[model samples]
Structures are given as C-alpha cells and as structure tokens.
Target: MATYNKRGYKPKTQKEKEEVVETDSATAEVFSSLDEGANKTEEWVSENQNIILIVVGVLVAIALGSWAYQVFRVEPRAEEALVESAQANEYYLQAVNATGEQQDSLYNMALEDSNGKYGLIKIAENYSGTPSGNIANYQAGMAYLNLGGANYQNAIDYLTAYDGDGSILEAYAAGGIGDALVQVDQKADAVSYYLKAADIQSNEFTTPKYLLKAAQAALDTGDNSTAVSSLERIEEEYPDAPEASTAKVLLAQAQIAD
Candidate 1:
C-alpha cells in the first residue's frame, strides 16, 4: 500500500523521483549555457585589448592634430590676410570715389601694387581660402569693370570666381557678369545671369533691379515668354521698386509678342 503524506497526497514512487531529477537537470542546463556565453565575452575582451588601445590612440592623435593646425596655421594666416585686405580696400575706395583719369589710375594701382604686398589681385592669389581673398575677387571685378572696354573679359572672369552667398556683393557680382555678357553681345547668357542675380538674394533693392535687366535682356533675345515672366514677378513681388513702372510697360509689350 502507498503511504499518504500531508494534504492527503501520496508519497513519491521511484518513477516520480526520476521525473524530478530530469526537471532539475533541464534548469541547470539553461544556467550553464548562460555562464558559457558570459565567459566567452570576457575572453574576447581580454584577447583584443591591444587592438582597442591602438584604435583609441589613433582617434586621439587625429583630434590633437586638428586642434594644432587651427591654432598654429589658420589663425595666423587669417590675421595676415585681414591686414593686407585693409590696404587693398583703401585703394578700392579711392578709385570708386574719384573721377575720370584719377579713378583709372587708382584702379590700376589697386590691381598691381609697387611693393607687391597689398592689392586685390595679390590678396586673392595669396590667400585664396580666406574671407578677404573672396572679397578681393569681387573688388577686382568691379575695378576692371570701372576701367571699361579693355578689361571686360577680366571683369567677367573675376566676377565669375566670386563664391560668397546671401550678400549684396554676391548679387552685384552676378549682375556685373551679366553686364559684361551684354557688352560681349551674349544676350541669352546675359538674361540667364541677370535672373540668377535676381533670385540669389531676392531682396527689394537688388532683386527688382536685376529682374528688370533680365526682362530687357530676354526681350532683346526675342524670348517674350521669359520677359513676361520676369516682368510679372517684379510687378507682383516688388511693386515699390523704381523699376516697377518700366516692368509694367515691358510686361505689356511681352504679352503682345506672346
């Protein structure tokens, strides 16, 4: 007969004891797998310590090299460029303010200094990556344009080299190139550049002026549709501009042609 234990449950037989041992074995096997994974992770970390150190060392060297370059090289060059640019700007101002032959003389001086240390062309060539260098490009273009006739291609080249954004100078540079193209009898290209200038900064001052110029250029090229489009933009978006009246007249002519 089987013996009854507490709660009226019968005592375990030999088969029941074997079942209990099997369940305990399964639980132990799960824990053993977990322990094996942890041990493998620790072994991998210990084996790759030298490789990890080398990677960290390389990263530190790169950061320090960048810091050193900025402190020792870039800052000094920028300061030198600033000093030279101030002198060039003085010549530029004199040339712009003076009249006739005096203006031509000063513009020539600004392009090529006797000492060769300070001038628009010199600064632009010497410090090509600096802000002053970029401004020099714009200045050189203006000086050449002001000189007139002989330097029109030079004006276009330097104006095209200007890469600054969202500034009055940038808009002026594009417009200057457009003006040069007109002088060269490139009416279609002139229209494209004028539109580019108008859209680059899109302000009340420069935008309306260039848009009007674009309309005129397009009309010259027999592009009535483009003329109408640019004129419409000026009338709608910049009604207060001085060119708005001219734009209205051009728009009327363009519509008739279209």
Candidate 2:
C-alpha cells in the first residue's frame, strides 16, 4: 500500500484524535453550562421583575428627592436667611463702633427689630441648616456678650449652638465663649475654652491673644502650671505679637507663683 503526502500536512495519531474529541466535548459542555446558567438567570429575573423594578424605582426616587430638597428647600431657605439677617448684621456692625446707650440699643436691634424683619435670633432659630442661619448664631451670641450682665448665659447658649467646624471663626466662637464664661465667673471653664481657642487655629493675631487669655484665666483658677505653659508658648512662639510683652510679664508672674 502507497501513502500520498501533502505539503505541511500531518496525519493525526489515534491518541491525538481522541484528544481532539475530548476537547470538543469539553467546549460543548462549557457552552451548554453557560446556556443553562443564562436560562436560569432569565427565569429568575422574570419571576422577580416586579421586586427588581420596585427597588430600582425606590433608588431613583431617593436620588431625585434629595436633589429636589437641596434645590428647592435648602437653597431657598438659605437665600431667605441671608436676606433676613442683613439688617441685623448692619445693626451689629453699628453697635461694634458705637458706645454706651447707642451700642446697647443697636445690639438690641440686631437681636430683635420691631421693623418686621427677622433679626439674628429669629433667623438662627428658623433657618437652622443654612449658612446664614449658622452665622446668625455667632452674631446673636456676640450681641448678647456685648450687652453683658445676665445675658452672658444667653451668649453661652448661642455660641455653644454655633457650628463653625473648619474655619477661623471656630476659634473666634470658642474665644467668645471663654470671654462670656469669664464674665459669668466660671474661671475654670473659661480657661478650658481659652486653651481650645488657642489650639484651634495657630495664627499671629488670634493665637497669642487667646494664649494670653488662657494664661490669665488659668492664673485666676489657681492653675499656675497651665498659666506658665501658656505664657511660655506665647513668649517663645509669638515673640513679635502684641501680646508677647504681656506674656513675658505673665510668665514671670506665673513662675514666681509656682
């Protein structure tokens, strides 16, 4: 028997033919498994179509509702709060520059005006989540503080409610609370808040000022250690500050007391 050979063509052995048959069977099984899985998935989806649609609808509704709330409710309220608090802010600015009876009158107007406009107090209470409303809390607190006397507690309340989390105003609010606490004779609490104010933001103006206040408050509370430490920080870190000379004297006094 004679075999005719073709160019670049090899005949498969018995084992090779068996391997090819096995490979084809494996590929068919894989495709069959995939088809079965797809069919099961299709059946499952058909059975749960209502539940799936409900979940998707709920998610869409939640997203739309949140967007609507921000656009409609929150934005409008913020604008309204800004407008309402403008007159109060003007009064507060005037009070800051004025003296004696006029100052008191202007501060009172900032808190509550009889001119049919919402004052700082009302704006803070009504538009709580808005930026302007948050600012109104700080303004109202300062107004009460400037008014002095029994209004110190009201200052404390409003300042405590203020949310100036990440700004320099946070330090200012803390210092204002410390001031109010000092006026109310809560020396230890005042010391705590003064230190907090100094720690919140480390700037040339506020840092040394609050550190000096902290040192003074600590001295008043018989916390000679804190007084010395705070005074020393100001003397070392803020030598060029306006409070530096005062801090030096306080440091000397604190060391002598210690």
Candidate 3:
C-alpha cells in the first residue's frame, strides 16, 4: 500500500490533530449539556403543570374581577354620588349667599340628609374613592365651618381628609382647614396651613387671601419671621390685591414684633 500528499498540502502534526479532536469534543459536550438542560426543564414543567395552570387561572380571575368591579360597582356609584350630591350642593351655594338663621338652616340642610336626598356628609362617607365624593367632603367641611361653634372640629376633620386634584379646590380646602384651626385657637397650625394654601396654586385671588390669613395667624402665634415673609410676599407679588393694603399694615407690625 502507498500514500501520496496533494500539491501544497501537508500532513497533520500530532499537536494539531490533538487540538482538532479537543475542539470537536468540546462542541459535542456543549450540545449534550444543552439537551440535558432541556430535558430537565421539560420534566420539571410536566411535574408542576397543575400548579402552573392554577396560578394562571388565579391571575386571570384577578384581572377579570378588577375589571368587573370598576365597571359594575365603581362607575355606577360615582355617577349616583354625583346625582345625589346635586341638591346638597345647591343648598350649600344658597347658604353662602344667605345670612343669619337662614344661612345656618341652609347649611344644615346641605350637611344632613333631607327629603330622601343624600347630603354632602353621606355622599362623602359612602362614595369615598369617587370624585363627587371628594367634592362632597370639601362642601361638607365648608358647611360645618359656616355653622361654627363645636362644628369647627367636624370642619377640621372633613377638610383634612379632602384631596384636591391640583386645582383651586386644593387651595380652598387648605384655607378652609386653616380657618377651622384658627377658630379652635390652633394658631401655629393655622399659620402653616394658610401658608400651604397660599403656595398650593398661586393666583391673585387665593394667593393674596391666604397670605394675609397666614400673616395674621403667624402674628397670633408669635412667629414674626413667617408673618413678615408672608406679608412681604403679598406686598411685592400682589400689590393690586385687596389684601395688599392689609398686608402692608401687618408687615409693619410683624417687623416691629421681630
């Protein structure tokens, strides 16, 4: 027998031949490992198939339950709350315009259920997560504040719970809380809330009004620095506001106190 090499071809070296064998073995081991891992994964999944199915079923049930709750319960309740609050809101607005005993009577009507209609208090309590319910809280707080006396505590409770959507209502709610605190002689707390109201959403109407209130509350609490700052802000930012004139007088007083 005889062997011949082709032109420009060389026979394999021992080291090269060994390296080729090692490379092929390494490739085969990788493929074998992958196959083994796949088989184990399949076995594990088969063993836990029932548990996996139950988990998926529970997830689907939760998603459907949330959807049904929003559609059937929350949406209808929100609409109902809005409708129920209409009469109470009207009474509240009328109370704002009325005076003396008439105003108190109207505010009482708005606060309590009457003629089978849900009042602001009931609306706020029942539909707590809804938008109309939230507005009911604000209205109820204002009504209690107007009613005065021991109702100041109720006003504080309701106004403190109100969460406004970055609107003017937020400033009004803070200012309302401040008013209730002042009535209760919590002057220091009242000053902070008044300042919060003035800062929540700055505008000519609410900003100057709350700033002036904050200054007075601060002065009452002997917080001369806060009083001075609030009054100065009003003088500089809201010179044309009705509160500005009062703010100037308070500013001089606060400076003297400081």
Stretches off by above 4 angstroms in model 2 are 1-40
How high is the CA lDDT of each candidate model? 0.88, 0.90, 0.91
Looking at model 1, the pairs that clash are: none
How much does candidate 2 score in TM-score?
Answer: 0.85
- TM-score preference between candidates 1 and 3, better one: 3
TM-score, one value per model? 0.81, 0.85, 0.83
Which is the leading candidate under lDDT? 3
Q: Write the per-residue lDDT of candidate 3 for residues 92-185, one digit (tens) a residue.
A: 9999999999999999999999989999989999989999899888989999998999999999889888999778998999999999999988
Model 2: per-residue lDDT, tens digit, 28-66? 999999999999999999999999999999999999999
Worst 10 residues of 2 by lDDT: 1-10
**lDDT tens readout by residue for model 1, 1-258:** 223323555447877556656756988999999999999988998999899899999999999999998898888888899987887788889999999999999998888865656789988888887888888999999999889887989999998888867787889999999998998899899998899899888899999999999999999999999999999999999999999999999899999998
User: Every model's Cα RMSD, please?
Assistant: 6.8, 5.2, 5.8
What order do you get sorting by lDDT, best first?
3, 2, 1
